[model samples]
Target chain A: MDNPKHGMTLIVKTITRLTVGLILLFGIYIVSHGHVSPGGGFAGGVIIALSFIHILLAFGKEVALKRISYNVASFFESLGAIMFITLALLGIGSGYFLLNFISKGEPFRLFSSGLIPLYNVAISFKVGAGLFIIFVILVTFRLTKKDDRE
Target chain B: MLELQILLVFMIIGAIVAVKTKDLLSAVIAVGTVGLGLSVAFLILKAPDLAIAQLVVEILVVIILIRATIRKDLPFSTSGRWFFNTFVVFVFLIVFLIFGYICMKDLPKFGEPIMKVAQSFLNNGLKDTGATNLVSSIVLDYRAYDTLGEATILFTAVIGVLAVMRKVGRKK
Candidate 1:
């Protein structure tokens, strides 16, 4: 806590900067490949959120907030929810809540799944933004002994 | 299977350490270790998806605990009614063991299940959902409503956190 400005040691910061992008890329790959891979929206979204939080930990709070402002995170979350609801509603044509209305493509290909990939994307958006907001909120309202000292 | 048993032992040790540790940080670490062990167990159980989800949830849980215990200190040795608590726990354990034993006769055999739904999915998941992965098809197509509910839950939780944490009349 000597130098609060630098959130962590140089090694952590360097490592974080190097791997954050890779983590983010991996998360995207997982989300996009949900129809074929073991991971889907939830796991990939968590990894994406972790990447942002990693940036926050390696750098300071201010820097991380700058990259994903509160408004932007809120927007992503809302948009994801709306998109999901709309997709479900669109299934009304097929007489179900979330019927895969879109014609199912050839199996085993990236573009095969009817609506699963889209749903995965929506879920990822919701999860990633929600997780980041939870982290940000917790960090902001963190309990401290500073009041007693003052 | 042997590796899984070893990890389960580690998990049990970690659980005991978490329960018995005086320091909150040590307790968190011990619980996290148990989480890691559980993820490994999931991997051994042939569920990489579960393992990934468990690992991520474990990390998020540690973060939440760290936030909650920033300056709070709860001593492990502060209880004076330990005997009463232990007695109650033992009573509950015995009751549960007896009940489980009674129910065991009716339990299905291990490694074999009446998996009609699973068999159908295995047979026609790709044809139905055009997804090669049966897990994905089941999650997003067959159980899309469940997925929707999960997303809604996350959305509501974030809104709850925002309502609790946001500064009044202050835009940042």
Candidate 2:
């Protein structure tokens, strides 16, 4: 049996690892700078998705799946969604939903956006988890089913 | 205007490519690029919130498409009726032209007085609502019901996906 890692030559492996690392770092940058810049939760989320895609393409779906299981991804997605909705419901007591019912402590500070930062965090988690789950489920079908050779 | 024109051209190309592609996977990717273009346009229009929402929704839609396509056997074909395709293209052009004309004619100027009013509300209304983010204040407090409905939609989608993808004979 050929090892899955054998699928990629040394150069390819190095490039793939570098690409994945850069993409993940870029995603974090986008998410953190969301309030101050144009890139926010959604852009950051897609960046993370691209990172996962790079890993899958470079290392194969089986390796990626092993690192991030379908079940765990789904659970993270569900949990993120639940957390977002719960934050919204907290607004209902004050006659609104998804309301940042907190006070903006200061201007132009990381924590100054009140619940905006928190919301961004939640959205990032939801987008990342959702995309990962989708990719896993879709790619699993292709990886698992082998052709019958007589 | 030049940049906008270039972006518009790219968007048109992406859309046309998406429509003409027969391979489901490639088509899906083209569609995603088109969506990314649209989101960029939204950002240029100074609607960051809408842009973010568009990006997120587009990602979700593309993921859904990928999952659906992977499960099914789809064949790619380049052959189709030319006249029918031309007719569809003509219809799309006419509809889009009219829509663009209306938008150009009637849309509010960016940073209009109403926007200032909204900004003031966010500035002052935070104290009353006890909210930090102006956007969040607008979304959750001023339009709580809308947020609830949006959340409900997400919940429904989650339930639907779970139901469709659930394994058979798996008892709780």
Candidate 3:
């Protein structure tokens, strides 16, 4: 499969790879240190989505689409929404809307946050899948040959 | 101070590039860069909550722009509507000036009494909420309603995408 063109070159490819790796690592750092630093699930998730966008720009939309199909991405997005809502319901039981760690109070530890970690994971999945789906749809529309249009 | 100046310069460049770019996709990305810069600035100001909100909204806006305009050619040049551009610039300048003044005046001093209050809240409240993460407590307990609203906004965006991108005869 040949790479589709969108001004991608070898330098772009190399930079994209390095950037994606760095973004993923940085995202983990952000989420893990969210309690102490200026980062959390949303920021981490956006960083992760950016990694996918870098891949799309470097490797082409076809490679990205193949790696994660639209259907699967949609499923993950919906699943994340469901999980978030479920957690919110759990909070209602405790007179809150998404409270976690009511039972286990482990402060100053990564695993200490009961639902925080789970929320981060859910958000990451949702953000990644949502972004992938959006990119695929947009790029697919953009890349279709003019002659192929109805 | 130097880092702040550099960040401000980069932010201005990103915003100008986003507004002036001809290519729609590049413009979208330029706008994203602006948002990214603002989020970083938010971190510097110790407003992580606002930063997260900014990032999430930025991503959603980018997605919506892509979905809406991907099929059309992104026109870089308008007929140079001078009056409209001037009006926009004037409004932007006024807003920026006001915000800049407010920020300078109302911002808390670094390492002040408020920091201690904030710290004590995090230190003591973490145990009661079962969340070791101070940010998580801020998000899920102290301000869970805002988080819920944010999630709903995303959900609405998903539904909007479904409505716009749906093909004929596709089952809902």
Candidate 4:
């Protein structure tokens, strides 16, 4: 009996394995430099989520799930939401909702923006995890239904 | 203006092809090409943010559409209903064009913005927010509430999708 792999051909898998890391890194860069650049947490996070999805397409569901399990993804999603809210709430400490409480360093520096970069990070995590969860749910439901039928 | 019109034409062609194409994959590609054309238009309009967002979104949409098609056989609409569908489409198109004409008649022409709120942001966004990037200053500082609302909507959507999928899985 052939225990076949779930995803695409060898070349695709190999390319995915090689490029997924690069994609993830690029997403992080975009998220971090969002203030200075065109891309932001939403865009970067989507790219980050897509990177994981690329793996899922190239390798198999099992392999991709192993890298980032459903529970972990769910946890990050919640955590990101909490962090975003917390950032906003913390602004209240400065006498305004979502105020820039921290000292803003020199412009163009990585740490210049007060709470903005942190918000970007939180948003990136939330968006990335949420998107991955949505994709996983969409893909896995049919498989689970099939199992139930069996 | 010519470049912008060229891009719009490409997008118009792409939209027509996307709808008319029988093959699901080709339709998706056509839609993606439309997205690309729209992004290029955005770039020409000097909205880098919109351009980047559009391009990324278009890619994600194509991926999702491809994934969806992988499971089901996606047949184009048969010629039997084509006449009716085409008629509806044309009616909508005319309605849209008329609405667009009405709106555009009063609207500022391309790149000419009569901005009040935007004027404030443009003038003092840096002085107030201490952020060099005005776009970031506006989004993260000047209008954080709107961003919060948007993020919440996204969260709600993700949760809804997850819940719906799980229910379908359990029922089956």
Candidate 5:
């Protein structure tokens, strides 16, 4: 199979291969530890989305799209929003919206916060996929000249 | 305080560079420098969460802006009316200074709670939400409605962008 030249030079590709997984891992860490740490869902999700964008920037659209298609990203984005709303609605069982119903575990622990970690996860998914798809759409879109349109 | 002042100066300088530069790519980088300085200033102000968010968001913005500048055949020109632009800049600066002074007068002293609500949150946020980080507790548990609205807005924005960018919205 003949492979046409795509993406950046060798150095950028090499650096991207090495760093993308680490960036993704760090983003997950931020999201999971949101309750106990500085970074929460929003920041972590942005980082997660950036990782995918980094892949697209370094490896070109085809390879990046192969890994996570536009449809898959859109699905995850909606799924995240639905999961968050459902979590909020579930709080009604406790007599209030978004009320923490589960037992609050020991403070300062990883699994301590009731519903917070879950919220973080949902938000991360929503933001990450939403931003990724936005970047993909904006970058891949081709604008034809007025002459061509005419 | 001195460090923050220095950072603010650097940010101002970067903003000036961003405005003065003719090349779109250089301007983007200069703006990134300002954002980086602001992020560091956020860290100095002890808002680590904002700092992290600012840093990452700055990186992403720079990346996206650089991509946009590089890939397009943008017919950007900086030879516009200089006197009007300078007048506008001066007007903006004066207004900003007035607002800044007013805000500074009204703001509570640093590290002090200005509102009973803030004090209450500080005192009981951990106990109520079981999250050691007060910001997280408040954002997720206390102000979840706001977050829901924010998520909905993001969803709407994505859908709008998809609709506008799609090659075909309806079948012929």
Candidate 6:
């Protein structure tokens, strides 16, 4: 298991390579179309995080971390929260926090919702990165190797 | 309604199996089955958002639970106090029944929509928020402060996880 060059069996690797991209794309579709669809930021973000976890399970930590490291994920998690708060505070000038200030475009269109798409994007970033971070920490943390940590 | 009742029965059976199973992996999968039934029930009830969310969350939870249990030392020691355990269970059942009785007294009739809020939301949600989905608008626009609070709670939870999982908590 400590080969570090590969992970799992060849069959699992082949299947993961074929399906992981599709899962990520589907998550993006869900987030982008949240205002018109069943899924929104939280659900889409969980799907996105699951995609990364799939890679980790099939290809091991080295490859998965090479794709998106812990530091980068943590950075994006904080950045997402800041972005969401900034969007909310932008509404304060109108006597309300998180007030829909943008022009409500023609309904049912892709870009119709005033600030909903942006909020979805922000929340997706937060949830996806946070969940992935939690999974990585929980999976990688070793009780015996405390002193020789990464 | 028939389908829902069947699904509920399946969920109850799964829960029983989960509690009765000795193998940790089997127990986890049984619990996952219960969640899967719940997700299906949500879909049958016309709650696509909740169904989708529940399904995805159930998948993640099962994976995490399996990871937490597999290859770990098993501790199945019993205290040999069945009488006390039964007494506690009886007390819990009494409290649960009382709460259920109170809730049943206030529950509206089946198929009756709570028109107070739903009517207005359905009538004006699209015009007000310019979104095709009323649920999204309600969650992200009308009740955005609620969403913000939820986001904050998630952020705090992540921060706490990071803090507790840190390799070196003190500057040694």
lDDT per model, in order? 0.86, 0.69, 0.71, 0.83, 0.89, 0.90
lDDT of 2 at A65: 72
Counted clashes in each candidate structure: 0, 1, 2, 0, 0, 0
lDDT tens digits by residue: candidate 4, B41-147: 88998888778778888888888788777645545546687889889999999999999989888978867878988998989876676666677778788888888
Question: Of the candidates shown, which would achieve the greatest lDDT relative to the real structure?
Answer: 6
TM-score for candidate 5: 0.90
Native contacts conserved, per model: 0.85, 0.12, 0.41, 0.52, 0.88, 0.79
RMSD of each: 3.1, 5.5, 5.7, 3.3, 3.0, 3.0
List candidate 6 segments past 4 Å from native. A1-5, A145-150, B170-172
Error of 5 at B121 (Å): 1.1
lDDT of 3 by residue, B75-163 (tens): 45446787899899999999999999888777777545467657766677766665655666777566767776876777676677666
Between candidates 1 and 3, the one scoring higher on TM-score is 1
Which parts of model 1 have CA positions greater than 4 angstroms off?
Answer: A1-4, A142-150, B76-80, B169-172
**lDDT digits (tens) for residues A9-37 of candidate 3:** 87877777667788778877776666545
What residue pairs are clashing in model 6?
none
Q: Candidate 1: what is its chain A TM-score?
A: 0.91
Q: What TM-score does chain B get in every candidate?
A: 0.86, 0.68, 0.63, 0.86, 0.83, 0.91
Write one digit per residue (lDDT tens) for candidate 1, span B45-126. Answer: 8888888889998998998898787676755465688889999999999999999999987877756777977998998887
Give the Å error, residue A134, model 5. 0.4
Question: Sort by DockQ, best first: what order?
Answer: 5, 6, 1, 4, 3, 2
- Which residue pairs collide, candidate 2? A88-A98
Lowest summed-lDDT stretch of 10 residues in model 5 chain B?
B69-78
Better of 2 and 4 by TM-score: 4
TM-score of chain A of 3: 0.76
Winner of 3 and 5 under lDDT: 5
Residue B63, model 5: Cα distance from true site in angstroms: 1.5
Error of 2 at B79 (Å): 10
* Tens-place lDDT digits, model 4, residues A1-150: 012457887778778777999999999998998887787788888889999988887777888899999999999998998998998898787698888888877777777778788888888898899889888887776555454443
Return whichever of 4 and 5 wins on lDDT.
5
